[model samples]
Target: MSTTGAAPGLSKAFYAIIAGVGGGTGRAVALRFARTYPVALLARGEASYADVVAEITRNGGEAVGVRADVSDEKSLAAALEVVKGKFQGKGLAVGVFNVSSPVSIKPFLETKLKDLDQSLAANARGLYNFAHATLPSLVESVSANPPYPPTLLVTGATAALRGSAGFGVFAAGKFAVRALSQSLAREFGPQGVHVAHVVVDGVIEGPRTKGYIVEGVEDGKLNPAAIAESYWHLHTQHRSAFTHELDLRPYAEKF
Candidate 1:
């Protein structure tokens, strides 16, 4: 949280990239990491990241926003090329996957195959494309001898742990994301890259959830800034003690 400058001992040639920049956690995370490294914000549209990029620049930090759809391999690859050009010799120090698919809450019988496909494309296939594109750079970064390990932090949801009655479609994709995260952690840990999955278990305080009521509980919704701080912590962890998974929720929320 210190605003002094980038983290101590960090190389100027290392940078961070966050996929899915928006008004909520994505924007918050981008700002948090920007404190320590030049950052690249990726989203499907410029509107999703424009303001966040401006904010970082305003604060004397380096940042760039790119429009890229993680679910589409070609789109994501092209975006990385832009990032490479912008950062030039910088190595990827951190990669955050915060993309989510639109949810269709309905009974299983009423659910359409298209809905399932959409979720899978954004959650599972999206991560697939993202990891393939970033992991090689992450692996290569190990030789850079960064102060912390190269890291990949994934954003998951409550649906990843349980398939609620109306959340079958969402759960199916989140579950795949979790499984993939675990596999990547195991495979990449020995190679000196940190891969972790984070389960965000409560409604986040954001533009979209402003009208939702959590009766009798003041500040019941999760704070996106707080979540971003946790991500910063994860990225700075020592490689000797890597955390493969972390779950976060508000204090008043039920388990």
Candidate 2:
């Protein structure tokens, strides 16, 4: 364990930071990262991450929860500063942007400007701010030769690829996010940052989706823990063969 930024005693242990944490995927990712490094979980409300943080800390892992709105740059910046202060000299080993844009499931003709604006803010603008804030540290981390590549993982959905009916606003935002991820991968990969976009194409198995019935398959939803394992794999991948984009879904999921 490291004494926070202010102290002369630096632990030499880097930290993993995650944005848009919640009870499902966010909690799983935080726990996965906590196994190796101090973890910072960021969400809009303490309720979203407090329990996860406590569980990590209780298990002898260093964890911190910060209330942050990814869509708001100032708030996101403040939360990141907290992360830096907590892990001070240790470089950032990984940064994950798991924010899902609010979906407007309405016909294109019925979609409003505000819905599109909200989606763009949460998906595109939020990622823009997050990358700007984290990349410098990630690049600097390259010199330290951390255990794995300094990675930035973005969470995407099927909307990132096809603009299906009734999902125009969501698709637009996800497409923009995918564009950002592709561009960032090119710009930063040579600089030692592993930027990858993960498209989760099916419904996730979580408390929120207990009632959602999937046709023929039993327990066919994607497990958040399994998704976390994939992310860890991405972080550990060799620089020689970096993955720019990856997609995951249940075995029963349709293309």
Candidate 3:
């Protein structure tokens, strides 16, 4: 997947919703977006997320923190309401960034049925509730008098499409999200709503990945800014040339 483009003026994007704000990459992405957009940081860890919200507001941006466990459908619905209330009538929400990961790394043989259910609840079912509930706002934003495009970005991992061992359950849930992106793209692309899946193909720059240049790893590989740029590109692609899948990694990262 190639990275490129900016066919129009930048929208204020008054409302930028980012889930999973406590983790490494999610925080970075949220901060970057908040630099120019009103951001809503959602995570189960409110105590930690509060600091992030303050920093954004202090930097002359608007932000609010909401708590929700992606594993709980009801919790996500309520969280979405909080987001909607925060951005109510702000010309609709310009984006929904699904940064939450539902599964952890575990060998297939050792993975339990319960583990699979847990992963699916957040990765697929949670996403369903997230998008289905937010679509009206997205459509409203795009059809506003002046017009705007709303981006639904699902940040997926390389394992999502590769389906390697030790990642059976995780991969299954990720794959479901991949399917969700493609279907939504087809269903909503023409309506000025862009849905895209981003595959971070290298080790994300995080605590566990620090100082980690392994044979199969790219040190400082998938920086949050790089992934965020892909979101920008996906959102700004021309109507005739929309990119549905974007693969991102450092220049030296291997497949």
> TM-score for all predictions?
0.96, 0.94, 0.87
| Candidate 1 TM-score, C-alpha based | 0.96
lDDT of 2 at 206: 86
Off by over 4 Å in 1: 1-6, 9-11
Q: Please, what are the lDDT tens digits per residue for candidate 3 over residues 170-217?
A: 888888988988898889888877787888787777766678875554
- Model 2 lDDT per residue over 1-255, tens place: 211122132225678899988877888999888888888899999999999999998888888999998889899999988888888888998999999776669988888899999999999998999999999999998888677788999999999999999999999999999999999999999998999999999989888888776657777888999999998888888888899999999988889
Candidate 1 local lDDT, residue 159: 94
Best by TM-score: 1
Model 2: residues >4 Å from true position, as ranges? 1-12
| lDDT tens readout by residue for model 1, 30-74 | 999888789999999999999999999999789999999999999
Off by over 4 Å in 3: 1-13, 145-148, 216-220
What residue pairs clash in candidate 2, if any at all? Answer: none
> Model 3: clashing residue pairs?
none
2 versus 3: better TM-score goes to? 2
Which 10 residues in a row give candidate 3 its minimum summed lDDT? 1-10
**Under the 3 Å rule for N, CA and C atoms, how many clashes does model 1 have?**
0
